[model samples]
Target chain A: DARVTQTPRHKVTEMGQEVTMRCQPILGHNTVFWYRQTMMQGLELLAYFRNRAPLDDSGMPKDRFSAEMPDATLATLKIQPSEPRDSAVYFCASDDEGTYEQYFGPGTRLTVT
Target chain B: AQSVTQPDIHITVSEGASLELRCNYSYGATPYLFWYVQSPGQGLQLLLKYFSGDTLVQGIKGFEAEFKRSQSSFNLRKPSVHWSDAAEYFCAVGEWAAGNKLTFGGGTRVLVKP
Candidate 1:
């Protein structure tokens, strides 16, 4: 079965550290999305890309957070100077053009101390 | 701006009992509605979506959701609950004009008891 894959299923870092999470979308899927989930905020879309081109990243903290699709298969989300408030589970999802449905990965759980 | 709201923070039901989860949305026009289930430590899984035509949409895992334009609601339901159904459920609204970006609700946690 086709599935989205994420690396570093769990990450624990100290404040001010940099953290990077990676995702590999299912082959042939053209749209990729990044989301962060926390107890307080629930789930929020951080960014999304279509055909390796970013469509939007307005929900991301531009100062410290960045998302990129280096290629069709690779997508990454990085956080610089991470804080305890940044601790949350980040999920990567993808879908084909015109398909309203999204297939999500297992997600990366990050904890900042 | 589009938004979704799931009124129930948590719902507890006995196994084999019927269950329903409420969802409400605010949008200017017709909205693309979806329901997703997230098991602990797992990613969200699409349970159902309502695009057009049918008000009642059937989905995987024996789940279904109905779209009511009058109420501006898309509620998920299951005929019988299973222990495996204990999970968090999210309702989302999407707009095609908005690059298919989804606005998700805070989510409802379901607890299935024996």
Candidate 2:
């Protein structure tokens, strides 16, 4: 079965470090979303891409966080000078056109010390 | 802005008992709703979703959720619970106007006892 794939299942970094998480959405899917999950915030949509073009990133911290889908198969979320509060599990999800159901990948857990 | 709320922060139920998790949402127009379950160290799994047509939607693992537009609620239910049902459940609302970005609830932690 097809599934979304994420890299760096766990990452530990000190404050002020840069963190990069990668996602490979299911092939043939046209939409990809990036979300951050925390105990306090639950799940927050950071950004998303449709048809290899970013549709929204308004929910992300523009100064420090960046999300990009350079190609259909690759999506990336990066945090520069990450802070302690940035610790959370990041999940990537993908969906096909004309459907609302999304398939999620195993999340990447980032811990900023 | 659109938002989702799951009133119960945590719930404990015995195995073989019935289960219900409440979900409430706030949005001006009709929105797509979804329920997902997240196991420890795993991504959120879609339990059910409501777009239109029927009010009740059935999902995998014997889970079902009923959408009540008048109450702005879509609650998940199951006839019998199992030990493996213990997980964090999230209710979400999709904003169709804006690339369908989903806003999720704080989540309800379910504990199943044998």
Candidate 3:
């Protein structure tokens, strides 16, 4: 079945550490989105890319978080000096051209100590 | 701006009982509504979506939802509940424009009692 795939399904790290999560969108999909899920915040959009170009990332923390789509199949979210508040599930989703529905990956659960 | 609201934080229903989850939205114009199910610690799965044409839309897993324009509500319903159906349900609203960013609701957690 066609599905989005994410790496490091779960992660635990110390504060001030660097964490990187990767995602592989379904083939032929050009739109990719990054979202963070937490208990306090149900779900929030962090960033989105359209056709390998950054479209909107206003929801993201520009200082510490960065998202990139290096190629059609690969998208990555990275955080430096991660804080405890950053511990949450990160999900990547993608959609093909002109499609309204977004297919989400299993997600990467990050735990910062 | 588009927004979604799922009022019930949690709901418990016995297996084989009927189920309903409430969702409301706010938008300047007609919006694309979606229902998603998320198993514990899993990604959200699309249950159903309503764009246009029919007000009542059928979804997978024997789920359905009706859009009421007067109330700005799109509620999800199931004829019979199953244990596997116990999960978190999210309501989302999106505009199908240049940016398809979806505004999601807080979500409602459903529990099925055997």
- DockQ of structure 2: 0.82
Per-residue lDDT of candidate 3, residues A24-64 (tens digit): 99999999999999999989999999999998999999999
Q: Backbone clashes per model, in order?
A: 0, 0, 0
Error of 3 at A24 (Å): 0.2
Per-candidate TM-score against the hidden true structure: 0.98, 0.97, 0.98
- Tens-digit lDDT track for model 3 on B1-112? 7788899999999999999999999998888899999999789999999999999999999999999999999999999999999999999998677577888999999999
A61, model 1: CA deviation in Å?
0.7
Please list the residue runs of candidate 3 whose C-alpha ends up more than 4 Å from where it truly belongs after superposition: none
Candidate 1 CAPRI level: high
Please give the distance, in angstroms, between residue B82's alpha carbon in candidate 3 and its true position after superposition.
Answer: 0.9
Model 1 deviation from the true structure expressed as Cα RMSD, one decimal place: 0.8
Better of 1 and 3 by lDDT: 1
Better of 2 and 3 by DockQ: 2
Residue B32 CA displacement from its true place in model 2, Å: 0.7
- Give the residue spans of candidate 1 off by over 4 A: none
* TM-score of candidate 1's A chain against the true A chain: 0.98
Per prediction, fnat is: 0.89, 0.79, 0.61
TM-score of chain A of each: 0.98, 0.97, 0.98
Expressed as tens digits, the lDDT of each residue in B11-114 for candidate 1 is 99999999999999999999999999999999999998988998999999999999999999999999999999999999999877867799999999999999
